[model samples]
Every structure is written in C-alpha cells, then in structure tokens.
Target: MPQVKGSKQYHMVVVPHRPVRRALIIVLLLVAAGAAVAASYYWGYHQGMTQQADAVAERDRLREEVSVLTRESEELRQQVANLRLGSEVDQQASDEMRKEVIKLEEQIAALEEDITFYRGLMAPGDNNTGLTIGALNVIGTDIPREYEYKLVVQQLATDHQVLSGYLNFNVVGRRGEQTETIPLHELSSQVDNEDIRLRFRYFQNIEGRLTLPEGFEPERIELMAQSTGSDRKTVEKKFGWLVQEL
Candidate 1:
C-alpha cells in the first residue's frame, strides 16, 4: 500500500465469511427463554408457599375448635352423672321416710287400741255389767309350732267387789283329720294348773307361751270364765285362731 496525499486510495483486505449475526441472535433468544423459565418457577414457588401456610393455619383452628368441643362434652357428661346420683340419693331417702312413716302409723294404732280397751275396763256400762271374757290374742313366734297367748277377763259389776274365778283356755282343732281339744296348761310351761286362777276386781291379763303339737292345726280357741261361791257366774267366748307373727 502506498499513501497518496490529497487523494482517496483503494486497498484490498481479507475478511472471513461466518454466520456471526445469526449466532448472536440465537444466544439472545436462549437468554430470554431462561429468564422466562426462572420467573415462572419463582412465581409458582411463592404461590405454593402461601397456600401451604393457609392450609396449616386452617388445620390449627379446626384442632382448637375440636378441643373446645371435647371439653364441653366431658362437662356435660359429668353433669349428667351428678344428676343421676342425686336422683338415686333422693329416691333412697324417700323410701326410708316412707318406711318410717308406716312404722309410726302402726305404733299409733296400737296405742289407740290400748286406750280404748282401758277406758272400757274402768267404766261400766248399764246393761253390759257382768263377768266376761274381754279379749284374746294369739301370736306366732319365729320358732315353728311356738306361740304366745294373751287372755283378758273383766268384771263389769257396779259393786266393784273382788272377783274370784277360774278360767279355762282350750284350743279346738284337728290332729290328722280327728277333732281334738288341747288344754292350755298342757301346752305351756308357764301355766302350772289346769284352771288358771283369776282374782282381779276389774280386769286380769293371763299371758303364756305355748307350743302346739306337731301337725296340730288349730281352728278356734274357747275360753270359759266362772266365778266361785257367792256370785256364781259363768261366761264363755270363742275366737278364731288367727296367728300374728312377731
């Protein structure tokens, strides 16, 4: 090459014919695709994390609600149990009170009967004045074939004189299909004499424990009260053998 002054010079140079522009365009496109893929991944990750946090918070709230409900249910069960126990206690107390009331009523009835009996014995009625059999009671004991008997004889005379009499107690019943009469003295250890002596002005109660013979079913009891010597009066009474157990 020669340098010429004040004029344009033409020279020849060598250059390689390669596809540099196409390669540069391809590289730029690849870089843009990578940036797009990174952005999509980051967004997806953020969205997933938010959703997971929301799910965890919801699960905690549901657990708390379930715990509260469980506590309430337990309290309700305890209240029901206490109510049932109280009801049972009240029922037991009611039953005991009922039993006590029944016992008191029975005692009152017995006292009233005794008051009436004593009043009748002390005062004499006009037409009903005589030596008579007042009452008879037969009670059963816990031991089989054993019984206690009570007999009351009253003299209802206006004179109020001392009464001397002998009383006879007899039990009439069947011993294996045969009619039999048993004396009270033979069946009881307390009565030594066959005729029990009655020496009372107003009334006298004769009580004794007796044992019935084996297989002897008593149907009725017969009592005979007879006064001696001056005022000879005889009174007889009969009673069914209704045994009250003690």
Candidate 2:
C-alpha cells in the first residue's frame, strides 16, 4: 500500500440476499394469516345474520298464533252473550202468550153464560112451542166411576101453568145385538131416588152426580120428562155418553 499526501478513503457495508428472502417469506405469511382471519370473520357475520332472520320468522309466527287465539276467544264471548239474551227473550214471550190464553178463556166462559140467560127471557105463547132439552153436558168427577151431569130443560110456553114433572135418567149400552139400559139412580149415591121432581116456569137447570158400575161403557143416555099433574105430557131426549175416569 502507498500513502499519498492528500488522498481520502470510504468504507462500504455489504448486505446478504438471504436476509431479503427471509423478510419476503415473513411478509407473505403475515398476508396469508390476515386473509384467513378476514374470511372467518365474514362467514361468522353471515351466519349471525341467518340466525337473526330465523329468529324474526319464529317471532312472527308466534304473534300470528296469539292473534288467532284472541279472535277466537272474542267470538266465543259474543256467542255466550247471545245465548243468555235469547233465553230471557224466549221466557218473556212465553209468559205473554200464557196471559193472553188465560184472558181468552175467561171471555169464552162469560159469553156462554150470557147466551143461556138471553134464551130464558124470550119465550113463545103458542102450544106448538113446547118443552125442549136445550143443552146437556156430562163431566167426570174426581172419584172413580162417578160423573156430574147438567141438563138444561127449556119451555116456550108459561101462560098455561108452571111445568111440574119428573125426570128419569137411563144409561144405555150395546150388548151384542140388543141395547141394554141401566137406571142411573140404581148406581148413584147423590141421585138416590129414581124419580126426580122437576118444577120450572121457563127453564130449569138439573145438575146431579151420577155413578156407573165398574167397566161399564155407556153408549148413550136417555132422559125422560113426564108431566105428572093435569096435562100429562111426556117428552123424551137422548144424548151421547162416553164413560171416562177422572
């Protein structure tokens, strides 16, 4: 080496290519690890979104079920209320109908009595208009084999004298081909005497209780009224009789 009087020298450092290769490999590994982490984060976010959507759908279904139940409950309540109101209305209607029926029954009874009274006031003087049996009704009594009967005997003439006669009641029934007759007085307690005295001017209502034998079905009733005093006029009347127990 030869040294000069005014020369300057510089020192330089040399880097190896192996260190660069190692740094590049380290950078690539970091980039790959970061990419993998990003991919995992994205997949987790999508999974969370899917799970949230499923939860929302399930909540909507539950709400729908609750709405249906509420509607059904309200409908049942309305039906129950309607049934209660309907029962009350029906009872009121039935009560009104029953009252109207009772009133009509009373009116009918009053009209019948008035008709009987008017017939007595009006009478004819001619002899052609004689005694007549106006109405006959037989009702079953409370006791067995006993019945009550009412007979309305009317006369159109009272100018001659008061009608004085005797009444005979006979129960007639069919025994095979012939008709059989049994006296009512024989089978009766209230109607003890066979001959009942009858005295009236215009009309006479003869009411008495009658009795029949056990298992006796009378087909008809024969009523005979005979004037016992001066004129001796005889009148006969018949009525249908069906035996019934109370």
Candidate with the greatest TM-score versus the true structure: 1
- TM-score of every candidate relative to the true structure: 0.58, 0.51
Deviation in angstroms for 227 in model 2? 2.2
Q: What TM-score does model 1 achieve against the real structure? A: 0.58
Query: In candidate 1, which residue ranges exceed 4 Å CA deviation?
Result: 1-93
lDDT, candidate 1, 74-135, per-residue tens: 55455545655765788765565556555655555554455555445455588777688987
lDDT of 2 by residue, 77-143 (tens): 5554565576578875566555655564555455445444443324344554556666778888888
- lDDT scores in order: 0.78, 0.69
Predicted structure 2: lDDT = 0.69
Candidate 2 Cα misplacement greater than 4 A, ranges: 1-95, 98-102, 109-113, 124-128, 158-160, 174-178, 229-232, 242-246
Pairs of residues clashing in candidate 1:
none
Q: Please count the clashing residue pairs in each candidate, in the order shown.
A: 0, 0
